[model samples]
Target chain A: MGILEVKDVSKRFGGLKALSDVNLSVEEGTVHAIIGPNGAGKSTLLNCFVGKLIPDTGSVMFEGHSLLGIKPHQINQLGVSRVFQTPEIFSELTVFENVMIACFAKRDGSFRLQPFKTVENETDIVEKAEQMLVDVSMIEKRDMHSASLSRGDKRRLEMAMCLAQDPKLLLLDEPTAGMARADTNNTIELLKDIQKQRGITMAIIEHDMHVVFSLADRITVLAQGTPIVEDVPEKIKGHPKVQEAYLGTAH
Target chain B: MKILGLNEKDSRFLLIVIFLTLATPVLLQPFPEGSGMAQFNAGYPDLMQRFAIFGIFAIGFNILFGLTGYLSFGHAAFLGIGSYAVVWMYKLLDYNVIWGLPLAVVVSGIVALGIGFISLRRSGIYFSILTLAFAQMMFVISYSDLFGRFVGTTITNGETGLQVYGNDPQVLLGATEPSSPHFFGIVMRENFWTPQFGDWQFTFNNGYYFCAVIAILAFYLSLRIFRSPFGLMLRAIKTNQNRLNYTGVHSRPYTLAAFVISGMYAGLAGGLLAAMDPLAGAERMQWTESGTVVLMTILGGAGTLMGPVLGAGFIKYFENIFSKINDNVLHQWFAWMPDGLEDAIVWVLHFFVGKGWHLTLGVLFMLVVIFLPGGLVEGGTRIWRFIRGTDRKEKTADATHQPEHVAYVAEKEEF
Candidate 1:
């Protein structure tokens, strides 16, 4: 069985159907890419996975448990982590402190109150955060405020923060949305290196074809509110439906 | 190197608070009694008691507002609840403050838990409005004879407030009860060390010391909270609640915990107020009183360790000292000037001194909020950094290395 199973999951906002009968299964050890145009319900599906929304029908199962009727933190506790489109980081904190907070969240559960113990005393979490920063090549900028980092570096730091949680499944929502060419290439390489080193399962939503082609082990092209094609990158590039989906909308 | 799990800097801050609380009587009495400046001296026992009491209140308020960025507009409800609890305890029990204080804290905590449970369901302005509504409801319930008509008993004693009475049943005390609240024969109002040096006489009152010790403990507790992981989570809630939830941390419980703890602190302050003065009034629970605590935190620098206490002392000093300055005093200060000039000076100062202290406070609050967004502590940091900048300029001889962002200014202010 796959690690994640979403069967007949549908969501409707008032009279608009955001998702309809979406069935997606992500195998335990694959980089699955969800690619679609702007209004194609990609974020809605991602939000459904992380308990930000409850589908009007059907179920989402991560590992062996149902992910419905639970809080967002409870979803995170189930080894699912998400990187936002806008890098929703603690802008007021240092990079190290930011990653360290995630590490603490991973080490301790959603509601542990260590009111007397300082974060400095959590040596294991600190070491893990430092290690994650090194993996992301962000150790040099660890002391800098998270807000001071460039857009690309902020995404990298955000990735490091997610990695610090030791998530089993990482969800990326347009990770390379607003990066320069150099930064986007660097991010692809970094994400590729991380996948190779850690064998982490990532489900990325991307509009960037280059990033999708570089990192995705499996590609699912979504159109309107349903998946039109699921294939390898080579097959996906030459698919007739993809051409119609892209070319039909171009003019 | 650490006290109560706080780091060296935090420990030092708490130590300074403890030292200052202990030395308040001496430090406030800087001027000799016969000097003109003695009129500005804030060493009187009642004023000192107010300083300690309000310091505790503001520190408690800071835990919710400063750390979590939750602006509660009804925190004074807890204070009022605490005072009422204490007064009820004294009326039923004895003149001993020990019986009333603990009950006050417990009742206030329970009331806070109830209010917080309901209010925390909503955030931002909604949360603030909920708390305000609860406080207003309490005020309205206690203000008139609603309770007297319904329950056949006056719970808050209506508008005159709840207080210890003469003819009440004294099960805890024998025939005679002290005129004021006491702790096992230690009178709250009793003072000593009236030795005169020149015209200066510094009276050390038991009431002030009692309140001071508790306030110092409250400060230490708040300092500990500021350094703890829980405190970090509270700050994270302020920064981004969504991010915290995504990080596998529940934001509501953490914020609720902060709210309840801060409420208890307000309760403790209220209990201390009643312990010293033995009165509970609904006016103390007004939303405006809650605004005063917010002003203290913001004016002193919210989220800083000592800001709330400093802000509380500043406001209390202004309320007591500046409000005491009349046109006559302003005339005395300008006596050396020509008669017309002296009159002019007094007239100009009249808009700020004495009864116009509130206007002065309003202007000062606006200036601090506008120019120094981080409040008085931020201004101090700015001055400190300016001094440091000049010192570094002499050595570095180059301006390129100094980044011109507000990032450095904020990060460097922690120490």
Candidate 2:
């Protein structure tokens, strides 16, 4: 069975059906891309996975545990980490602190009240946080405030934060949406390296064809709040159904 | 180099705090006795005790408001609860403050848990209003002695305040006990030593030292909290709760723990006040008292380690010394100025002194908020940097760097 399973999931916003009868599963240790045009329910479906939205019908299970009606932090503790469309690092804190928080969460679960213990004395956590920064090539900027980082650096830091959790599933929502070509290529390379090294299961919702084609092993194409095509990346490249979803049916 | 599990830098800070608190009686009495500026001297036992007590209160409040950015507007209720708890202990147990003080902390912490649980359900202004509402309800109950009426005992004793009655049973009282809030027979109000140096005189009292020691302990604990992982989580909450939650750190329990801890601090302060005076008043729970701690925390520097203590001392100094400056004091200072100019100046200055001391505080608060958003600690850092000429060097360095790096430097100064 897949690590994450979505079965006949449907979500509606008042009169509009944002996601309708959507069924998808992400296999273990594979990059699964959910790509759609502007009006499709890509974000809505992703939100449902993260406990930001409750589906109107059907179930979403992560490793056989239901991912519905729980808080975002609880879902994260259950081994699901999400990267937002915009970088969501703690802007007021230093880069080291931003990653250290994720490491603390990973080791301590959703909550641990260790008020008397010093952060500097926690040797293991400090080492883990430093290693994560090194992995992201952000060790030099660790002392610098996260807010001052360039957009590309911020994205990389966010990725490092997600990876620090050692999450079973990583959800990426348009990681390269607002990046320049060079930054986008850098992100693609970084993703490829992470996939090769860690074999992390990633569910990416993307509008970028380049990112999807470069990283996704399995592709699911959605149109008008419904999935129309599901296949491997090579098959998805020239599929008529995918073209129909993107460019609309002839005439 | 590391004492008390703290790093070298933190241990140094703690040592400095301990030295300053212990030497307060001497340092505060810089003016020689009977000198022209003698009126500014705040080394007296009553005021010195107040400085330490409120320092503890503000330091505690800073953990919640400063770290989590949870602005509580009803913390005074905890203070009142603490005072009442101590007084009740005195009535039921004995005149010794040891019995009452710990009870006060426990009582206040329990109460804070309830208040924090309900208030924390809402964030931002709603959370503030919720705490305020709870505090006001507490004030009304204490003011009217509603609890006393329901329980058929003198709990708060209403507007008359709660005090040890002659007829009440002091079960633990000994015939030889000094009575009237003593620490194992050492009277709180009595001064044990008065040392004179040149023209300056300093009086060291039993109660001030007690409060000073407690305040130092409280400050040390706060410093530890600031460096702790939980403290980092609280700051992360302040900056970005959304990111913190998605990272698998729950924000609610952290905020609640901070709230309860700070409330216990307030309780300790209140109990200390009662221990010194042996009286609990309903007025202690007023919203104005709640606002004062907020002022102290912000005035000192909300997020800094030493800010709250400095702010508490500053406001207390103003409340006592500046308020003592009346029309006569103003007239004495401006006597040399031409009569009309002196009269005009005193008339205007009078509004900022005496009962109008709040006006001076208001102006100072406005100036700090506008020019030094990071409060007195930032101002101190700036002046220190200026003296070292590092600020100029940094500015030059910043000018040559990329724009984003410059923003980083500026933001670092605010912390």
Candidate 3:
């Protein structure tokens, strides 16, 4: 059994099968990428992993735990974290506060009702969040509002927020979908750095072939609600079926 | 603690604000009654009292609306339940406040838990409608004659409300008061000192001061919550519920906890209201009252620390001052205008202001929603920025950096 495994996971929406008989396995501490055209069921599969959607007939196991019926937060508690395609930061709050919340969650669980105390007083949590911010080069923008940051900076802050949780498996849905070339390169570098330092397994969904080639150790090509190709990035790039299914649409 | 990013300076600033607030009644003692200064004192304590009470209400509501983005329409029911509990305590027990207040808080919290559990199962407009229905049900129950037709939902016994005397044997012995009441206190006979000058006088009362102190404590408590990790989680809930869940934070418990905590604050406010006069009526839980708190939160600025207090003061000030203005007052102001023109203007003013203060409020609400969505705080910030010549500079800079169309396109693409 791999560190994370999905077996025959199928999801149907009304008459349309969003995901059908999809099987994939993620080895520990490797960067895995899922690439497909729009409506290729990449996001739906990610949703299933994070418990956002329940699969019709499948079992998702993470570190020996059954993730099928678990809630999203419960999945996070089980050493899994997800970053959405869009930057999701507390816009009104400062960058430091945004990361601090995630750190608090990792340390204190999800629900804490300490009324008279401040979270910053927690030394260990603060140190971890600060280190994560520094790693993402967001320490300078820590005091600025997350909403006021540039798109690249916002993504960095979001990455720091996810990292603060110290999850074993991180699921990223299109981390560089709308970013400029420079920002996308920066994100790729950040992901590389995180993988090197933390040795945490990552499952990233992306449409950009450049991002897939640069970062993914293993690439899975999904099309029409099924996995068409799953192999090393080099093999995935040359696959005839993946080219016919995905490259045809991209061109 | 400094761990959450709040340092000594911010805490000290809050301390000074609280100190000035608590000392206002004593510091303004020399101001003559009916004079502007004295009116400030006379009006402020009650207004500040509301600021604290409703601040708790809004903060609790904010937990739901701000964090979860779930707007509740029935929060007034929680407040009403709190008030009714306090009033019942006054009737059954003596007004020592030690037991009555805690009981009110606990009961209200329990009620909130029940309401939140049921309401949180739904999201968006459905959740708001569910809450509204619950609040209306509470209002109907309170107004129902099934409880007691003549006694009303809450009975003050007399206009003075429930009174306690030191001479009362049950109170002195720390026991529950008997059904039959007899004695009144000599303490009531002494007239408190009132400083007067010409047309104005400043009179101080112990009851008002007591409520004022409680209000200050509540305000300080809310300030703490606003800066706490719990508050951060609530904001995260508001910003992106799905993101929060994906990050492994269970949104339900956090939202429910916030609901309960806010309910307790409302309960404490209700207890104080009863303590000041010693009567709790079911009418306090009306949907209008719930809407009033929403108005207070939005009018202040939903997420800002001090916005609710400012909003509460603005609303209460309007209610007190605007309600007093009559047609004669309008006629006095516009007397210099030509007779026909003055009469027409007064007629029009009558439709918008004076007894029709709601019309003015409604217009103000629309203006705030459209022009100042951030409410009074944002408006004040805008004015400050304008005075500093930074507003134009900031907007131009923002405009050059990101075109509106591009941002919209980016947002649409993400969706």
lDDT of each: 0.84, 0.90, 0.71
TM-score of chain A of each: 0.96, 0.99, 0.96
Candidate 1 chain B weakest lDDT stretch, 10 residues: B406-415
Candidate 1 lDDT at B335 equals: 98
Candidate 1 lDDT over A204-230, as tens digits, reads 999899999999999988887888899
Q: What would the per-residue lDDT of candidate 2 be over residues A73-181, giving only the tens digit for each residue?
A: 9999999999999999988778888999999999998788998999989999999999999998989987777877899999999999999999899999999989999
Candidate 3 lDDT over A1-251, as tens digits, reads 67899999999999999999999999998999999988999999998897768899989999899898778788899999888788987675668878888888788786767767766677887888889889898788767666789998988888898899888999999999899999999999999999998998999999999998999999988999999889998888778898789658554
Q: How would you order the candidates by TM-score, starting with the best?
A: 2, 1, 3
Q: Tens digits of per-residue lDDT for model 3 on B1-415?
A: 3322447755665676567656554554556554534433433344444544665566556545544456777878777666656656545555455556778789888988898889777766667788889888767766663344465543333323333434433433344433322112212112245555575444444445555566666666666675577767876766666667766677788778877777777777676666545556667777898888788777876666566667766777677667667788788789999999999999999977677988888888889867877677778867888888774445323221111111100111110
Candidate 1 clash pair list: none
Candidate 2 local lDDT, B284-324, one digit each (tens):
99999999999998898887788899999999999999999
Cα shift from native, residue B14, model 2 (Å): 0.7
At residue B12, candidate 1 shows an lDDT of: 77
List, for all models, the DockQ compared with the true complex: 0.51, 0.55, 0.46
Q: Give the worst 10-residue stretch by lDDT in candidate 2 chain A.
A: A140-149
In Å, residue A84's CA in model 1 sits off its true spot by 0.6
Clashes of 1: 0
Q: Model 1 off-target regions past 4 Å? A: A249-251, B174-179, B390-415
